[model samples]
Target: MTLDDALAALKSHVEEGRAEGMAAYHKQTREVLGIPNPALNDLTKSWRQTLTVEERVALADQLWQSDIFEARIAAAKLLTQARLRPDAAAWALIQSWVPDFDSWAIADHVCMAGQKRLVADPSRVDAVEGWTQSDHMWTRRAALVVTLPWTKQNNPKSDDLAIRDRVLGWAASYVEDHEWFIQKAVAWWLRDLSKHDPDRTRAFLDAHGEKMKAFARKEAGKHLT
Candidate 1:
């Protein structure tokens, strides 16, 4: 119920020897709890069921401020549900975390939670567009990662199609960035889009792939055939 109580619950799951390996893997300098994802998943699932929306928000904020790896992951999982009606607070809190992202593991988990909010209200993409212009790479990358749902629609309606293209425009803007993560995010969006919309994927590669890093270009075209 309290932040200390939630953190104590997280600490109870820490594995003794795994902390160093997790820190090395994520290249994160923060305190790593070494709690495996399955355990964190199970824990946060129970927390989500047991806690009210405001309680979850407060807990997630505290967990994130702890700067402990697994605690941050737990914070994200707490708000990852798709049907949190009137989720303005959850969505706002998730947005607040974007600029603080320093690792892919944390950013990806937060983005997963973000995808649910975006799906609940597509207009949120307008706010996400600002992330594309952000000076932070992780914030920029979050834009693509969170909008991934747009890639999976095999029979999207006109509005969904528009949203998909809007995200593609963001990807295109990122092509010249040359950062490994940015290129990867661009390729990830394109590669996933290739699965359901090969034409758009190919078109993206044809236009911007030439400007992307060679590895990213290859990845963007991986499923194009």
Candidate 2:
């Protein structure tokens, strides 16, 4: 389908008055199509089933360039699959969107899609590591957000454990960044990691909790004990 057709399909699902409320909630200045997430989820699922990877990537790029909030969300959902062979294009496109991230809502959705690609190719973390040093807080935050899958492995092997530790090193470096969102991302990674590796979580807290914002420190320790 063409971009016009996809935009038409998305516009068809907009809810009356929800757009205004969503815009305010997300602090979004762009066009906010008041489509609920379930609708976008269903829409992208069908699109994924029908569209080839190249088609979906092209469409996702169009939707993202539209700068319409829900369309961006749909773009992210369109590529959120766990397995997409030769996903280099999708991964690269997602990377291209990083510098454009200005809000948590869209960034989180795209980062979820990114988690799939990163897990599909863990070596990509090398590129993601550079994001940790970016001046853009959201981009730096995306580094933690996308790497979150490493936190959930119940019985991690040597390499998975190595990745998990590597991401922790990133989190540790973030402790000095006092931005609320950055601290939250660090806490989020640790909180999730705590479920699967409490000892590591506690160790992180013991070593760096003294420097963390109280809320983040509490959040990182929430699952422990």
Q: What is the lDDT of candidate 1?
A: 0.93
Candidate 1 clashes between residue pairs 3 or more apart in a chain or in different chains: none
Report RMSD (Å) for each prediction in the order shown. 0.7, 0.7
Candidate 1 local lDDT, 158-184, one digit each (tens): 999999999999998999999999999
Which tens-of-lDDT digit does each residue in 1-225 have in candidate 2? 998999999999989999999999999999998999889989999999999999999999999999999999999999999989779999999999999999999999999999999989999999999998999999999999999999999989999999999999999999999999999999999999999999999999999999999999999899899
**Candidate 1 segments whose C-alpha is farther than 4 A from its true place:** none
Task: Give the Cα lDDT of each candidate.
Answer: 0.93, 0.95
As for candidate 2, its clashing pairs are: none
The deviation in Å at residue 130 for candidate 1 is 0.5
